[model samples]
Target: MIDGERDLIREMARLTHSPLGHAELVYPWGQGVLSGVSGPRKWQREVLEAIGEHLTGSATRHRPCRIARASGHGIGKSALIAMVVKWALDTCVDTRIILTANTESQLLTKTGPEIAKWANLSITSDWFTATATALSSTRKGHERSWRADLVTWSTSNTEAFAGLHNMGKRIVLVFDEASGINAKVWEVALGALTDADTEIIFLAFGNPTQSTGTFRGLFGKQRDLWNTAQIDSRTVEGTNKAYLGELVATYGLDSDLVRVRVLGQFPSASSMQFIERAVVSAARTREPAPALGTDPVIFGVDCARFGDDHSTLAIRCGRDARSRPWKRWHHMDSMTLAGDIAVEAGRWKPDAIFVDAGNIGAAVIDRLRQLLPDILVSEVWFGSTRVREANWNAGGSGGTRIRVANKRAEMWTNMRHWLESGCIPDHQGLEDDLTGPEYGFDAEQAVMLEKKDHMKARGLASPDDGDALACTFAEPVQPRAVPGWLDPERYGRQRGGSEEGGLYRDLGNG
Candidate 1:
């Protein structure tokens, strides 16, 4: 690399390490003085130089440039974006740069004033109309307001950026704190890039999140079009020792932010999860061939009827020096009720099979029994028993741990534990179902609003999926489940008949 290129990278890293000022912003093309571009702090300087480098780069002269920055909170994100806007307006005439955030109030309240504070219009006017909020330039008719040539909104809302005409001019569309926007809004914001004559420069900044969908994919894709950088919390450790202390102290040494923004990595996404997503995600890779007797030797059966439910069977080895615990699942809701699950279950010769005794489980269980009576197919039935579930108080300040009674609560909990640990180590179907964020523990509690609903409810939404998954891996607790008002044999017959259980049995419906 040339010394100039090396200097730019060094200066960029240096600026990133400390504060920035307008005067400190030196372009290789020409270093000139600007109005209020000087930032008085470390992060400020970093941001200014970053924006300056782009403003002066070839990307600005013709093609658009995209920069994705993942920054820590209070890292002067809003301040830098404003200065970047000023740098753009002064150098690039008729530049229609847009400033956007998660909200509009932020635009007017935060980004707007930052520009107004630094934008020093040429005082060509020899006289000023004090009564009217207008200043006449000495060059007369050349009077310009001390205002920003920028627009901002709280949302990556499409409408806010709509009606934009690039007109062969480069467009600087800045998406600040993009993680706050929804998927649809993000799509709309990105669509603004497709304008003709508009060399769409997509600039986005946000804290890292593992669950971020498309942004993650773009940055992850092996390409040269995008430049990405991460400003970690540790960058401010020496300066903001207090905040750093609290983070390290309050969150312990294993801080999520350390793994996230500091490392420029996506942290584990799931809540209530025992193991990390990174560990689970890595397990998806193909491992080398296992020595003899290393491949899986057991299958788990968590079966369900067709239509509106999931019928899953997972296989795990007794010992896996050769393979990771893998799970495979099939959604019965996507199909119809049939004896196909039973046939498939018999072929595996699993060490043990756990089946839930609700609805079609009984018939499937019975059929599997008919096929391989000797195979240890453990039948899990439910009775009203106490189960542990976390209950939160009204204020949302904190929560309480308590036990509530539920039919298959224990089974669900254990299944989650096993899946989380990658112990169900062979079936991809179970792995996928368990990995999905949609399972809920249906305890027999009749208290407050549902606590463990889906993400909205802070609970998994695919409990049915979890059911098929857990049942496939569950160790049976009860001999049988017999809801009141039904004969044992009749109950089994009725459950076997319907995909969704019988009219008489009011088991865990959801």
Candidate 2:
């Protein structure tokens, strides 16, 4: 390493000497190591200066200010912040660095341990001891005060935010991993920034998740608030893939925790409850084999009515190694008891009938069991009771007698895989459900949820056909044999009525 690189590492080492407080920060890095010069690089130096500049410039009244940064992952952002915190603590007297994250556990698991480790290794002074200053609230249900005692580590909350009220005096409130902060939390932090001399350094880092929310709101003019560096997975300059392999050996790659903790990127949640998208898309591509009834069939049922949501039936005739949903028949209906299912069940004559034992479904299920008594009946359940319910209370479930539906979320995931992979022949199923503003991935919980509590509130109560179609992906399937005496022709589209009746053609008589 060059003299400058060595000097930079020495500087980083020296930050451990800083005085600990409520608003001071100490983060010093060896330019070569921190920024990637020969032994490291200049990027670190530039980033540090940029931060210094932003702080000075934003301090309009020399008032402590706020800085927000939204950047992608893996550019050594966390290391940089630690170094800065170290620097601030070493130089400023009683400097308080109020560090906060989405939760105290996250701050502990993600930031605290690492900072403590670094200090342990670098500090020559006998000053730092780590313990929780805040963990529980008072018996009266007020904010906890444990943080009031600890100098180096403290619980972070709106109350701890009193640190931000020191005006004219220099203070720094650092928000670690700001992506998880919601609007409510944002306001709490805002309220605490009552100090003019308090430097508001909002350092946030996260990967892309949605087009809306906090990170999206900070995209353009405010990006400079953060250095917003993104380090891609190519070889970092000084090493080849194998050399990089050596580094990986020192770090735990198997720990998905490391990805977010060390680099600030959201890791894959590892979902396994549903069929993957490739399976759904592949199933869509499959043509009904003439051999299905002879072999056995797996059915997909979607029982949404046509007015607002669709009713769909997806019939798959095989298992995973060769599973395929050969057909998806969907439509919207103004009337609930349209007799379409009894007619189709007759034609499809599935090895089993997989129906959503949900809203308006009991009548349909009863109708099918009455007509196709010889065929096995399986009522598949999906969604909440507020939205729909399968009356499993009617009987118990055992091997294939009938099965409760798997989580609708798992089913939706499987469906997403199909749509994005381009393997599915028709995206119509996903299209109808997600195309509307009603669907959105929740920002806080990191899952999809209804955007509006009362969708279609202004209008008449309408069934969601998209839900019906989606249910097909998650619906329980089974195979059933046709009655020994039944004919495929007899299953023609007709609600059970006199064969030569007073039926309307639109009701399926035509």
Backbone clashes in each candidate structure, one number apiece?
44, 52
For model 1, residues 320-392, the per-residue Cα lDDT tens digits are 3124232334555312322454455446445556666665667756666666676665666644354445332
Per-model TM values vs. the true structure = 0.53, 0.39
lDDT of each: 0.47, 0.43
lDDT of 2: 0.43
Off by over 4 Å in 2: 1-43, 58-78, 101-110, 113-158, 177-187, 206-227, 233-510
Model 1 segments more than 4 A misplaced: 1-64, 102-112, 120-158, 161-167, 209-226, 233-252, 257-275, 282-314, 317-412, 419-471, 474-510
What TM-score quantifies how close candidate 2 is to the native fold?
0.39
